[model samples]
Target chain A: MEHYNMNLTLKVWRQKNASDSGKFETYPVKNISSEMSFLEMIDVLNEELISEGKDPIAFDHDCREGICGACSMYINGRPHGPWHANTTCQLHMRAYKDGDTVVIEPWRANSFPVIKDLVVDRSAFDRIIQAGGYISVNTGNAVDANAIAINKDNADAAFAAAACIGCGACVAACKNSSALLFVSAKVSHLALLPQGNPERKTRAMNMVAQMDKEGFGSCTNTGACEAVCPKEISIENIARLNREYMMAGASADK
Target chain B: MKWSELFTSSIGKKWVMALTGLFLIIFLIVHAGINACIWANDGGVMFNKAAHFMGSTVVIRIAEIGLFLGIFLHIIQGLMLEFQNRSKRKKGYEVPMGNKGSKWYSRSMGLLGTILLLFFILHWWHFWVPARFIGHEELTEIEINGVHMHNMYNLMQYTFQELWVVIAYVIACISLCWHLIHGFQSAFRTVGVSNSKYMALIQNVGIGYSIIISLAFAMMPVSMYLGWV
Candidate 1:
């Protein structure tokens, strides 16, 4: 197999701060190996910018692989580039051809405001998770792990829901900027488990209420969130969230 | 926490859309059933009698006001939501995924709604103004055993004979089908009827209702166009 190299033009969003207006700045990177990941290609451009003593483009990343999901970029009009259920870190350069111009931008939802070039302050997500993402952890002797016999299907579904990495890709992909997928994933993961049963009602209600407070738009079931979610979290999780919230609202503790 | 939050909040707005949408759906059912009586082929006797009762009855007259208000509320709230959703993304993608990401009608609800609104205005112009305000003096009046009634069936027959009006109706019914496809199940979801066991049932019911009701509506004109009735 012969190695392929491409010279690409990058139109990257450059934002000074959260309050600053942003614009796209063009940069050219040459001789990029097709095998390099999309982020690694960006690294080459950052290296050149640093050598010239210019402020390098700022972005977020942790694991180079897809799991961490710290890497998020709206590349060429898509969250995580033009790939099915992939993170930006996992996108390889071979997806592009020589002389192709790639446009990169930060997630554009007001709820996930831009912090700098291609990086957004997704802390709103943290607040939503903080609202009710955790289960009741009673301070006592450690409970036996296998004490609760969980059904296999429920456990599998819960595990699938738990795979979400809080990437905000769902918000970026949603036309409404809705956090339904992320909130649903968190809600469904815990709602399916016995440990989560105690706070199930409040958890569902509070999480949704928090999500609403964050100014995220409503979910219209466009399925774009699931389409772009690296975890492939199902729309079924959203349905379950609605179920939980409804049950909570109708519950009468008085 | 404010009372206004029930209409302004995202979820509250959803509640308004859903409740108004479902209420309008009930109105559609009753309206469709009554119109279906035109198929009785009894020279519009039963249809005219039913129309007379609906027009003359005070309870139904009061409910008609609620129906009109519900429709207006649904339209206004839907426009607000559509604008809100649009404003959420101030920029457009360089390459939209289009149907690859979501259904066309899902994203085009605002556009479909506008079409429906225009169609509805035309609908009211053709029938409602004539029946309620113009005194039905010019309309063909019939007596069924000495009971006075407007021959609404003749009104419909005359209305549907025009090809353009029939075409407009067919297009309007198509839009209604797509609107109901998402709206029906979505309304239920917003109201918290999202149980997995029953959601499948609800979805099927939604699709079934969309197809049957829209087709029923479209057929009214198509049948008249073809002189089937």
Candidate 2:
């Protein structure tokens, strides 16, 4: 719990654009505070780069609190650095020591093409959400929470699935770049609720169709996604997704 | 969803792998059971009877076609999945995260399947082709209770006599062990057995089944080669 200062070497990925062949560029940071977050360390390094008249690194980060799912980039081979159930924004420099070298790179996947230095286009996730990751709810006053009368276990599981922050860490961690963890989380979050009953079948079917159309790879159940998930989403949702999709295929009217 | 999409969709394709994989899992039990008859040691009379029954019975003969089809679909879909999955990551990581996320064998299904495929081809050539075709010249003819049959026991004995063949078989079984260790629970997971209560059970069963089946298979060749039977 003691704070300390450390000097570190960073090998960061740099690319002009999606079409540009990216390469790693190394930078040296002096006296970084252990109490600073990983992104804060990057911010310090960026400021120094700007002072040196070099183009500062471009990375995606919205909430430094780790909820927005924007903070991404593989730090030393792991998705969000060497922490369990943690994100980049929550990763502190304290995890490292003096004179350690860290290699950072953007998510590597055909579906997630790199847009710039340490940033990839993750709109594929948006499209998959658009493909039935919702329920048909009438616009009106907020419904009473007690009206649903959901099972406690189902509600808990649904909440767990809902914890997914739409981060591409699952896909980034996956060797196949499969988005099943993300898709399954979305599907299970809704599918487990009674409000999600009407379009459950179509939701499962259509979302998967869109997932495949987006050129994401099929899942091989390697548990890599669950391992690197920032929110610690379980692959159990993937099994639920598979079950939902199959049942929908078997009985859907259309 | 169109019926065609049943096999075309990503989940659909996984369903195929799981169903076919489960079928093959069952087939392994039958195979190991029949092969265990070698322990009867009555000069392979029991083993030969079981092999002859499997080869000659009308019901089983028809089922054999289904078995081959199951294996064929499992292999083809496995290859397609592998190739497609590989293309998803066109760019390789600068620093590899080897076995940090999952076990090596879980991520190496393609490699293990390829090894198993090569082994199967040799296995079929050694036993299946001759038992099914190539006439009786290659197989010794024997009669049990007036029921004449090809002596597959002799073929197994003869084929395993060579050290290379025994070693190859054992290596293949080791690969089979690794494959089943992942595939068994994976098949259950694919079929939607996501309940936390059953997950641990399935995982433990998968590991035990993989070891037992593969060990039984590996021992067959070893036993034959060493003249233990």
Candidate 3:
């Protein structure tokens, strides 16, 4: 791909700590390559900050590859920049014009508090998952993947649900601050498989309880999460979560 | 109420929201069908009779109770879910601004729902309660083909005569339609039909159904005020 030299301006969020007052700070970069990924551009800016005697802007990233989902950013008015099914680390500078002004900030929600510039602690997701994501399979029990022989349809559905990377993008994207997409993905992923059957009742009950405890808003099904999701996880998973929950409630009565 | 249980437990308030939302979808379908009868040109006799049957003492009482429960459950569940979502972000993450993946409606459900709730109260007070308890005095008596008829048409026309009422009704109808488009398929999905093949069909059906219902309902008042019916 041919790379074009581009000039850019960034209005980035800056916070010293969680309790510190935060604000947007503008920075200018000259002659950036259009082929550069969004995070790589940020790397160039951090070098500029450090050399100029300023603290490097803090942000999260693990695998520069999209699979890790470590880089989370809202570019312009979009999550993970403008590319569909693309994470921030994978979004190329080519998507923008030569002298574009990009507004970047941390995900805004009462549930997500900013730890530093462009980084908010996302451990709420970990708490939600720990609530009851997995079935109690013994470590020593080595069951073959084909041993259960799940139907092709169910397996596909389960895999799709499992594709969720526990990214808080859905929550950030929702106006209600609802985590239905994330929670539902977890519920549907397990609910679709046979191994999840043994703890289905407890799983549904526990996960939903954990969801409420975490302070996530209820889903009104506006489908914004599915639209912004890098994985394009569907709202149907939420419905399945509801079904699993209701069935669990019914069976618990017996 | 335990912190661990609320975040970790699966069969809690989230399920309540999903279940109540599904029930309301059923109610909306029945309501839209009833309102559509106003367009039939039978001197409004069929519509009046149907309305009367629905307003009968026993049926009215049952419906009143059900409506109360449905609205109550929906609102309570909604508030609880909102609280839970807020609590989770006590500590924030380092993410950027502007979520392009989300839609306008998804973020505005709270506002839409609040408007719809206000409209529901006014609707009940203006038509439902008055027709049942106050005995439809707003309607005039007319002679139609040697038969004595009640001018329910005139009553409807008069209600829509005020520009504010018409405006409010129009706004409410739009909000209701928006809510239905998301709520309809969502209710289905919550019941566990997330299959890709079927979901696309459901989403389309949901959108079409909401548009048809909103237009059908809005036309009745507009047409009545314009003296077309």
Candidate 4:
């Protein structure tokens, strides 16, 4: 692996809370290793903050692995830094040149209010999911996984949908703030599988209603979500979600 | 806000966008088909008859309401999604790497959409509103073989006779075609039909349909102006 030492300028957002007006504060770091992950660089900055008798900048993180969907940051203009299918934590300094200036900010959206510096409230996503998702599976029954016998085709589709980590990266990448990619993945994952059939209609209807209620934008058929998705989720899932929604709307009176 | 439930779960705003987009796709196909009928005959008789029928009582009223709702839902949802996505973008670090996976049109849907909106306004002002309220006299009147037609044919011919009008129509058709190319497949994908086994086939079919319909509709006026049936 290629290694290099680099000096960098960081312009980071500083926010006290959701209501506070945020601003960018610049910090300089010298002699950073090329192998350091983006979050590790933030860790170094936070350490400096603590040493300076300042409150360390707060940001969300879990699983330093890219799967948890907790560490969301817009690097430059793109959703998850520069690398395709990689999250902020997975982004290595090698992707940047020495002496590069990096601007780091929390995700900007009305629905995702700023929680603090570098972290925003993404809980609107939860309300949408809770409104509709998951079939009313019985707790007592331990049905064999193979017993349901999902087609390999459906299984593959579900696996693709399951790849969505709920990162909201798609929302960030989209110009319209559309969440169709994320929601459709979830809907399609279940809808394509027979196991999800029982609640398919309700799931589509309720989830869509919840999404609209939360004041998210409609899909414009732009593939930005797929473009920036850390998991590389396809817009196909969104189409599936649409089909499910139509069917659900048609049968809503039932 | 329950943080655990939000980022950890799917089935949120994304699905709503997908669904609404797909619905609009259906509407576009139907609308394109209706518009294509304008070029079906040498004279505009068949087209005007069809337009008249479409502009008739019950169907027209239902279509008006549906169109309003459809456009409203699409715009509202599109804006919300953009906002949500904006909130999730990573902060301040430029990547020199070019966008690899997305199609050009997919990335530029907003621009195309804006163009389409402008076209819609012009379309309404030129055709729909005048046809509905102003009648043919204010626009242009045409009589062919003793038929007291509304002169929609003459109007179309006259409009396309202008070079700028022809160019505008072509540009609008291109935009519509590009929009539909992505929109059609996207709708299918959102509704869960994206399988690699048939993904390319479906994409091709979707693109074909979009191009054919948009080109057919756009070509009607061009043909009229060129005096080519």
Which pairs of residues collide in candidate 2? none
Segments of candidate 2 deviating more than 4 angstroms: B136-138
Model 1, span A1-254: residue lDDT tens: 46799999999989899888878899999999999999999999999999999989999999988998799898877789888889999999989999999999888788988888888889999999999988768798998999999999999999999999999999998989999899999999999989889888878878888988888998877778988888899888876776676556656353
TM-score of chain B of each: 0.96, 0.97, 0.81, 0.79
What docking grade applies to model 1?
acceptable
Q: Which stretches of candidate 1 lie over 4 Å from their true place?
A: A252-254, B1-9, B56-66, B91-94, B161-163, B191-205, B225-228
Candidate 4 accuracy as TM-score: 0.74
The digit string of per-residue lDDT tens for model 2 on B1-229 reads 7788876888898999999999999999999999999998799899888888787668998999899999999998899899999999999899977887899999999999999999999999898888877754548888899989888888888888899999999999999999999999999999999998899999999999999999999999999999998
Q: What TM-score does prediction 2 earn?
A: 0.98
Which one wins by lDDT: 2 or 3? 2
Q: Sort all candidates by lDDT, best to worst.
A: 2, 1, 3, 4
lDDT (CA) per prediction: 0.86, 0.92, 0.75, 0.73
Listed models, DockQ each: 0.46, 0.82, 0.40, 0.25
Scored on chain A only, each candidate's TM-score is: 0.97, 0.98, 0.96, 0.96
DockQ of 4: 0.25
What are the per-residue Cα lDDT tens digits for candidate 1 across B1-229? Answer: 3345334656556777888999988888988899898899887788888888899988998998999899999998788888888888776665665666788887787888889999999999888999887845447877789987787888888888899999999999999999999888878877766457787998899999989999999999998889988
Model 3 per-residue lDDT tens digits across residues B1-229: 3443333343345455557777777777777777667778775766665555565568777886887797898886665655555554554434433334545665556667889889988887777666545647686666655655455556676788877787788899899898777777766765677577898898899899889878877777787777777
Residue B109 of model 2: what lDDT?
98
Top model number, TM-score: 2
Best by lDDT: 2
- List the candidate 3 regions with Cα displacement exceeding 4 Å: A138-145, B1-42, B75-99, B134-154, B161-164
How close is each model in CA RMSD to the real structure?
Answer: 2.8, 1.1, 4.1, 6.2
Reference interface contacts recovered per candidate: 0.44, 0.74, 0.53, 0.36
